[model samples]
Target: MELLVIVGVFFLLCAVFFIRTVSKKKAVDKAVDVDKDDSYAFEAIGALFTAAERSFYGVLTQSLKDNYVLLGKVRVADIIKPQGNLNRSEWQTAFNQISRKHIDFVICDKDNLSILCAIELNDSSHNKADRAQRDAFLSRALSSANIPFVEFTAKRSYVIRDIQNELHQFLAQQSSQTPSADTKICPCCSSQLVERVSKRGKNQGNTFWGCSAYPKCRYVEES
Candidate 1:
């Protein structure tokens, strides 16, 4: 009877030890997971803009003065959402394309911060196949949005007046296109028509009328 009792106690102790071993393993794993959950360790980037971008920013500050708001590295998705007509899956697909893309610089209305234009500081890389394709996509997207897009080739030195002239030219165009009582309603979306300027290729700097709802309606009338 004593021998049987000893064997039973021995088995009981073995099970207890196995349970303790598993508990220790789980505790250690939990500790490791807690250590991994740390959210810190982020470091500051020395400056917001690269040397080239900084140089241009200076000129923009000078050119825009206090008349407009300038925001850098603005996300395209923030400026325009997928049109309401899109089905959920279609919206998700469209949103995914631009959720991470950014415009190099964005000029916005001072009062409301409405995007007046998006600018790209183009270097020679823009001429390459990949960059060109990406630029084309952005161009198409922004055009569909009816927001003005401007491009300036990167240069070792920039002329402030030149920048002012081009930007003001666009602003002037916008001023001219400002809606009046005579402006017609968009037949597609029922939004009023807005004036727009072409920003690319041979037709660049040309003016046209586009639906105010823009990317959503994409209705156009020749100016």
Candidate 2:
């Protein structure tokens, strides 16, 4: 009887250890899955920002050529999408004196070697008082420096084409006082037929003169 009782106790201890080990393994698996899902979500957001930047550049390029504004000499920076508040802290502090959502773009005027503008694109999720306050601060900063600061909020779902049109109108208004004689040359090929903004890619919003002899004498420079 004593031996039998000892054997039963040993079996009970083994079962308890087995259950605990299984539970721990399941928890680890769950954590890994959550991390993977978060990574995927982040990648998706990055792709969206890239697309928006490209669309904005395309519109600006077309508008400049069609409207004969600034002789297509304006320069736009690449779209800068910060990952989190930490990444955007410095810019936020400069504009709003606080760290919040990331900035979208830092635009410049290559003609006079001055910063022309800064743009922020907000989605439905950004409709909070904090965001408004930040925008107000940015507006004040830009206004004081005689620079243009613009904001665009999605009416419903974010549409790339609509945003592009809005950007074109804003650029036209801003460059109204610019002179046509201020034609910019493409730095790469020294071509005078250069148009502002990059021809392709995520840096599409960047203002640079590209050669009309693209693909052959491809050259570009920030206006």
Candidate 1, poorest ten consecutive residues by summed lDDT = 169-178
Per-residue CA lDDT of candidate 2, range 137-202, in tens? 666544443345667654334455555565553344223243357655446644344445542467
lDDT of 1 at 41: 77
Candidate maximizing lDDT: 1
lDDT tens digits by residue: candidate 1, 1-223: 9999999999999999999999999999988998898764778998988899999988898888565779998898998778899999999999999999999999875544556789999988889999899888888888776677889999999999999889874554232244678867778866666667776768788877876544446788878
lDDT of 1: 0.80
Instruction: Record all residue pairs in model 1 with backbone atoms less than 3 Å apart, i.e. clashing.
Output: 144-215
Q: Candidate 2: which pairs clash?
A: 75-207, 76-206, 76-207, 110-223
Off by over 4 Å in 1: 1-36, 173-223
For candidate 2, what is the TM-score?
0.34
Model 2 whole-model lDDT (C-alpha atoms): 0.50
Q: What is the lDDT of residue 177 in candidate 1?
A: 40
TM-score of each: 0.65, 0.34
Error of 1 at 161 (Å): 1.6
